[model samples]
Target chain A: MSAQPNPTLSVALEHVEELARGLGESGDALALRERARDLVTPLVLPDRARHLWRYTNPERFVPVADPTVLAPVAIAHEWPREDDLAAAALIAGGALRMVEIDDTARRAGVVIEDLHRAATDGLLGSLVPPEHGFAEAINTAAWHGGVLVRVPAGVELEHPIRVRCVASAEPVSVPRVLVVAGAGSAFELVEGHVGGGVPALVLGVTEIAVGPDARVRYSLVQRWDAGVTGHLTARARLERGAHFQMSLASFGGSLYKADVGAVLAGEGAQAEMFGVSMGGEKQHMDHHTEHLHEARKTHSNLDFKVALTGAARSAYTGMIRIAHDAGGSEAYQVNRNLLLSEDARAESIPELEILTDDVRCSHGATVAPLDEEQVFYLKSRGLPHFQAMRLIVYGFLGQTLQRLPATTRERIEALVASRLHEE
Target chain B: MTDSTNAVFSCADVHIWVGEKEVVKGVDLTVMPGEIHAIMGPNGSGKSTLANGLMGHPLYTVEGRLTLAGEDVSALSADEKARKGMFLAFQYPVAIPGVTVASFLRAAVSARRGAEVPIRDFRKELLARMADLDMDTAFAGRYLNDGFSGGEKKRVEILQMLMLQPRFALLDETDSGLDIDALKVVSKGINAASTPEVGMVLVTHYQRLLNYVRPHVVHVFMDGRIVRSGGPELALELEERGYDWLEPAAAAGGA
Candidate 1:
């Protein structure tokens, strides 16, 4: 519980005060700002000694005291349109630039709007409590114009909703999102983060609520420039008989840290999480995930794969916790890492805590270099060295990537291939 | 087979070392076009080492000369040699979990031809070859060697040989784990690919494989060197009498 003093935290705290003063008399907004202030006071910045932050250095991120410092930048809106099932929202420089929902979805009572306005409507702040961590606290306090998405009860969207966030050349940017799936609603979401190589810092938070019997599939792809430092945090809750599926891919960023957690709070709830991360050329990427089964008959499964090369480093930690009352629950977790070069390094840790004898929990982890036999076999068939390596790396990651929605999976695969082939 | 005039594949005074230990001692071998030379030996007699060493596996330190079509390729890499019209059917084909068999063969075929093959033509050719080998068409969509049975893995290897049409090929224990039916199917594929311009060297530990695919010459490999060399009858004779009789002679020759 020792407080770790961080310049970035102090700067963020000061910025929160300025933002709170600007709110004036908006009751819910003012109340949320006050709660954020309270949460920031005793907040202890995590250090390398903390298990979750052991592989990530928080000092690398420089905080922005003034939200106005980031000038809005235009983002290209090129997207595939064959399915006509996609809705998109674009945010740039901490501001919502554009939001688009298909006519069918809009007519079905799906709400996609600015979080600042959503706050006044009493639809923000509850899903992501301010007391989560330093990153969450700062995001809750400093996010300028985040996006909020809500699908009404009994509505099922045919296609996915895409959210794209572009950070400007500014030294720091905070992006926030909140998603709510009403009871019996079904939808999918794809969130992407990208920016120019301007040595910036991005702090992002996403909160999701899956109502009873709702089905939601969410994916996040982080492809920031090599000069960016990204810290992304996410929390999700599942109601009775709800199904929540999530996938994450990290292919860029000089230093990236992601913390994601899911809570199965009702009977018969299920969660499946899959992730793939590739790091190269002095990059450091860390991912941490948690599954909390708080009710009986809850099920959770997590599989994460990572590949590192060229002096890059990565760390993955997954934990499954089954409460004493969560009898008949089943949880499985696996983390696999492949090191493509001698200088590359990776560490995987999978842990489990089951408080009930009737519950089933298992975890496994593996870290190793590329299999020489497989490479030789590919080469023996006339493939050049680089092609052989590429095929093997794709094969290694395809296990998790194949589980993603087809279009999203292909898009991420192309991004990963381009990043891997970068000189 | 020692007639260097028309020999498509030749190895002279080659020694292979894995780390500091020599796995293949000084050896000389030559295979003329249209001839199948079978190298028979007891278990752990360095048959695989010789095959891999000739194929220029990176793990082994090789000395002396390996030639194909009168060009010295002693320093060429595996892929480089493969592109130069040489192929090796691995004893244990490694599984590539996500790359489909069709994609891998297409790449290999393109590399061999130095150009891309049209999809329709490639599919037609692939399906025809697969049918000839009694392989199911569904395997083309499956991951290369991933979750494949032993017989299926061997069949895929021969299929690659047929598709690439290498001038010289080496089969390393390709018949080891296959049953009678699978062995015949694999052997048929190998025989069909053996043209007058292609030379082959099949390495095996038993004579069961030689029954399906006939070999013009048989060489008994003991330890790391060839202890005996003769016609096809040599394989049958060794099958009747185990390799124990040749151990003393091979040791004496080495000393």
Candidate 2:
């Protein structure tokens, strides 16, 4: 099949060809490699597209060839000692030592480790489901290292599992993270990505699978350095009676495109996705998410709120898809954004596709500045102009942060508050 | 009835402006302890502006004196005014999302009481009050004033006034947007909160509310000033004959 050809898509295909050549002449890896190569020429890219690169200009995230030479991947530095439950380090292009929890998590049958070991042992394919997009194929072909977590059946974790993935150099960090929750299990997983170096590119990917009757609370806090340019793709699958809660906060990045999505694959499953992003100083952050109902009797809700400051820009696009056989399903999507500066810009679009007549689905979005009444209320309480604005904005985002548990709220707010600027 | 000698709230020839346009001009008004006085006026008569100004709204500027219980509260903030036993049941209450009713009420009560309210005692007291207003116990779990009907918001406002036990209150159009049943419930709430220790100022555009909650006196305002002062019969006279009934007196009052 022919796909639209644009410069960005061409650049992506060129990078895929280089990666395929580096993979050498292997058989099993060849299948995944060939799949990626085929996507390079077939996936269409345009200034205005629906699915991939909707929020961000695909040209900015396209990989450019280097004339010098291939550089070696460096290991990331070890994280400082803290009171965190569990921690892992990914420096450069490889995995560091995995942090073992004190005891509670271990007893709860939580397995957090490096994905290289899991992939080498043929466990990655069984854990995380497959993806069919161009970015997914490119990630499957060139990913280096990542974090993997597995929760056993009937196990409940009181503490959140924290995963820190870092990229020290300019390399496609196909950071694949496979999180599989056994049936009847419940847990929280916090994933963060931090990195800094020269003007380089980092492509990140993650696949999550939540088992039947399981509940998985997942959060992704992406605060890449201001100089980094890249795209990130993450997808999740939920089985029957499973519930998934996803939260994302993007604070800093040069040119970033993030695609986050989930699929309800069984009856009685539910998913709620929440996102908050702030862009400043010419930064552009494109965040797209979708919830697909593939079975009957499923429910899903999505809320995304963003703030654009300075000359920065952001785009939020989300979709809720209900299959024809997925009768008796319910879905809702809302995206609200605030434009803080005249130069700042934000666009939000929430779409719904219902193939069945027995389902209820609705989508809406609003992009505007802060409400005058809310601002006046805060000011009447003695806060200055900027302080009042900050309070109102914080209170706006605090809606999403308040949805988390107490401890999780504490952690997420600490990061969000720091990233917020008074003006 | 209590003595009218007590100074519940005293405004000395107050001049107020909203965006360079004078709303309350050289006006004097007072309400003594245990007295419920209703201020009836036509639209643009600044009745609502006066109520909001007393509550320390930043949207208005005041150039005169305001005192509550012998305390000069002219410079006090809204929350500070609340601590001084002054409350306002806004005509249009703001919806504070992400804050549950129980949490906001508890916090407000704590702030007013300056002490932590015991959970059991709080729940017991809140449930009793909810029953008084015919509110479902589940209402406490929803977000504060979020998605509440007009009548429900007014009930919540009165609920706060009742629980806070304020010394002076400004009920701004609290009865403007309620059905007969809701009006009865709201009036009952106001009547319950009206003890000899509290004084209330009811600012409304309609005299229909006066039927449920009788006031000792009613004042007619026009052109940013109170043009005439009379008994409760003045309200009925104005409602029946409309503001045209005051045209002759308004002209004779020297404008």
Candidate 3:
């Protein structure tokens, strides 16, 4: 690992060490925290010419020195069907606060508690891989006061678990979430992220471990403000015969990068991933998705769509990897970009690594402006110029929008519509 | 030439060009209020081109003057002309995958009325119009024209016409792919939208639609020019004899 080029980023690494020392713990938690702190200085910055860093600057996400505000962020955004949720949690200042669990889920052996306290149980960092990159290590070292949700085997929760995370600038707010779905259990999760339009950084990490034969549906919507530079990594690891459905939506941010992937580790496991993002003004968003087939007879599909307007830019990369032993696996990936204006730019890249000859894997990508026939059709119906453009953009992202979690569906939809009207 | 001051829709020496080639060559027509004119022709006769060109489709270049209710509208854009009370039922209405039928109609109605319509009033009006067309009412919630059958597409076109209530409408092959029941339902929608103030131009390759909705005047369009114009009897004669003789008549009349 090379020395940090920026003095401020180097100070950021010292701060992580300082934070780890402040914990003053012994045993596994201290080892994990110190390991992350040690990794910060030795980890090398990704090269500019690398595939993941080709479109976006890697230095923008390096956490800078800022006053760590420990107060909880004010809840300003709207959520959906609040009363019907099985669990509702507010995450900010690296601490999970104001969490409530329904009596039904509580009696059914669903556990929702503080992550730091749960760490001693040897569950923290269980699903997080040891070979993670810089952002994942930084999150592990800096984040605290997060949530750990555990659902016991054979228990099914009818209502979705809702989590609203707010990260204030100047604090380098890092929110961590970990979920464990037991075997033969079923559950749904809806997460919302907000607060980031300042000079500071917001890095978040989420990991889901789907047990054998478990069913899980997870969705997240991001509504950060412009000028907020954020980095988030979300991944799910599936066990034998498990089924997982995931979605991620990003509507606002100055520069936000998301890495969402699913690992099909169990035979006959299936996963579906859908992503939606909209960029306007000077917003820059980069999204990367991966579906790794590590077991035989696994199936996976991914669809990601981005609509860019104004001078906004988006870069999307989708990857599908099949291991040597994963014969008879099927994987498909599709990325579509809708450029609403001439000034707005989009880059679509597809990456695939198939080690086995018996697997079926394919990927497709397209970058196009608004459909002329579609716009003409709308205009002929007496819709004005801007309305026609808005309708077309809305329709371009329709597939992912329709796949959002039911609890966050209404709120996310209204936010998208309001953003379209502003343009 | 005497000016028909009360004519709702009129075009003078209209020529439509698709790319470098001329499709509709110097065709002239006038339609008055309370009138339904069938522009009948066989395949590739430019009937659809004429219909699309008159409504300001971008792919076709039109050279002529089009007037609606005594106001010239040839220089305006498609949406502007639509706001000026002109509508064209497309031969192949494009599919908009995400926008619901109800929402799309709301936008169209809002554009025509120059303001946003109230939701309650819009919903009531939409339900009533759907009932008038014998539609399932669930169609309002579906994405606009996406995955819709051919008959359903035509029905939605008529539904748009009913909602917009334009003074002049150009229907381009609205009956080509309809079954018997669907054809009747669409015919009913067309009839319901045709009021005394509306002038309709129905372009068809056959007289199938005319059997249900009687036309006051019929024009036999051959090779983009109207070779014969008469009362409703012309449509019956063409339906019986077919369009095979039109080339001879077109040649004989030097059209």
Candidate 4:
């Protein structure tokens, strides 16, 4: 046993161990339980360290207080027992409001269910990979409860349904999600986080399974409070002819690290990931993404842009892998950063690993600051320094906004303008 | 005081140094309102430097008095001088990304006027001025000069000059890269901005622009000072004879 781990971490780990045992006696559940037992040992605690915990140390984020005294609480919702949108409802926000999934989805032969019931029915263990060390360990150890979402075959939904998770009065919140979309189904999912005044942490893990011929648009908005730290990991498997579109916006948080991955398990699978991150003050935001092409005729493109101001810092590392049999695959990745101040820092690394010569793959990275001549030109037109900076910053991040829906784009622009005012 | 008494801009014994290279040395220039004055010189003759100095660029060290509308503006920032009714249509305008030309002009107008102009009136004025320049309506929505064609960028600059309505304007090589049609349009725009209350200093390396702009006074700038001041015929003469013949004459006269 590891010298009786820190009180805050020990209790959290103990809670996860107990919960993993109750997640049903399946292959994933048994594997997670065995892993949970090892988490308290010296080998897992000190010997096997994680680069993911480089900042916002997990021990500090998750306090190890007694779990027996913990309260069983569910977020207050406006509607109860509603499954309007397709896809199994996975993790609901701590301060979430349940809404009707809309009449259009109900008429499209889509079946929507809650994650709590899915877990009770043993569907959760089958979706989550027991190999995700930190995220899996975090969820198996400490997730209070979550949602499950499933989209029926051949259903198409026009409007995107958002599941906003706002944090309040919690030092640590672990959220679990499981999403399954059937073949030929199309839907949009937005997972959002909004934070308040509390000093908090979020360990978020999401597992998505995209069936053959399905199209999924997933957007993650991390607008945490300045007092919070977040560690999020999301993974998806795309079968034959499926498409996955992901957009990530990290606009807040003192420290955040997000690990996102996509596995192209079938032929003709395609994935496109886009992200924009803005950091201020002493904030640090890091993103790591991987595209694994295990089959032939797969395609993937990744674009990540980060703007750093004040003394903030950001680091992005992205990789694309083409397996030996994954010939004729096209993969491209780019990471660009705009430095706003002398003290602001940015690091970008775009890498590709290919075992097949028939594949077309390229990766590039760039880091630059606001052009002084451009600022001078604007100032010469009588705009102040701050106004000029705002203009350039907005343009630098406008590419990501162009990837969003019209209404969502407007809302994001308003949010960015409001944040600039705060500065 | 009716015709030549406005004294739009006056520079006395202006000596400018750009990082130890004395570009404009002991020059004197004055432009009275309602008259178009052209400064014709070859490359590296400090014509653009004089224009930039009048706009109060920090890069140039000024050793003389620069007065705009009879007010001393030698010590102001470039933007401050611009707000004080002095404009420079740059030789190569820098593209300011993320800023629309319309919004940039509105901000500049508000800064110059020292108050917020009503949106309705501002919009009306912007449309009127844009139409006057024969500019495409789509130009207003574009990021300021970003990825603009050479001719299109110059038109945008002229549009800004007309909207600001400054007391004195400095046209720095505005006709450098323009074709005949663009040159005609640009000259028309300059003429439109030249009222009895506004004066202009047109700087160009080629005297071909002088044919259309029709300057009342033409000055030859060599080693910064006005080496020779004459009627518009001097520009025509320089176009025929070139600067080699006058360099020796000016040198002899200076000695």
User: lDDT per model, in order?
Assistant: 0.85, 0.74, 0.83, 0.75
TM-score of each: 0.95, 0.75, 0.86, 0.85
Per-prediction DockQ comes to 0.80, 0.16, 0.62, 0.50
Clashes of each: 0, 1, 3, 20
Over A1-423, each residue of candidate 4 has an lDDT whose tens digit, in order, gives 232344334443444444544443345554554564355332233322333433334444343443212344455433232333433233334312343456667666554544433433454544454445544565554555455566778887776666666554555666666677889989888777766456776777777889999999888888888978777788889999999998888888887878897999999999999888888888888888889999999999988888888899887878788999999999999888998889999887766789999998889888998787677666666666687778777777776677775545665677677666766
User: In CAPRI terms, where does candidate 3 land?
Assistant: medium
Clashing pairs in 2: A76-A91
DockQ, candidate no. 1? 0.80
TM-score of 3: 0.86
TM for candidate 4 is: 0.85
The candidate scoring highest on lDDT is 1
Model 1: per-residue lDDT, tens digit, A343-384? Answer: 999888776788999988888888989888888888887889
The local lDDT score (0 to 100) that residue B155 gets in candidate 4 is 90
Please rank every candidate by DockQ, starting with the best.
1, 3, 4, 2
Best-to-worst order by TM-score is 1, 3, 4, 2
lDDT assessment of candidate 3: 0.83
Using DockQ, give the best candidate's number: 1
lDDT of 1 by residue, B1-255 (tens): 467766899998889899998988888999999999999998888989999988878888999898998888888899999999999999999889888999889988998888999999999999999999988999999999989999999999999999999999999999989999999999999899889989999999999999998999899998889988999999999989989989997898694
Candidate 4 Cα misplacement greater than 4 A, ranges: A1-12, A17-100, A106-114, A119-130, B1-5, B12-22, B56-65, B97-142, B245-255
In Å, residue A113's CA in model 2 sits off its true spot by 4.2
Between prediction 1 and prediction 4, which has the larger TM-score?
Answer: 1
Worst 10 residues of 2 chain B by lDDT: B1-10
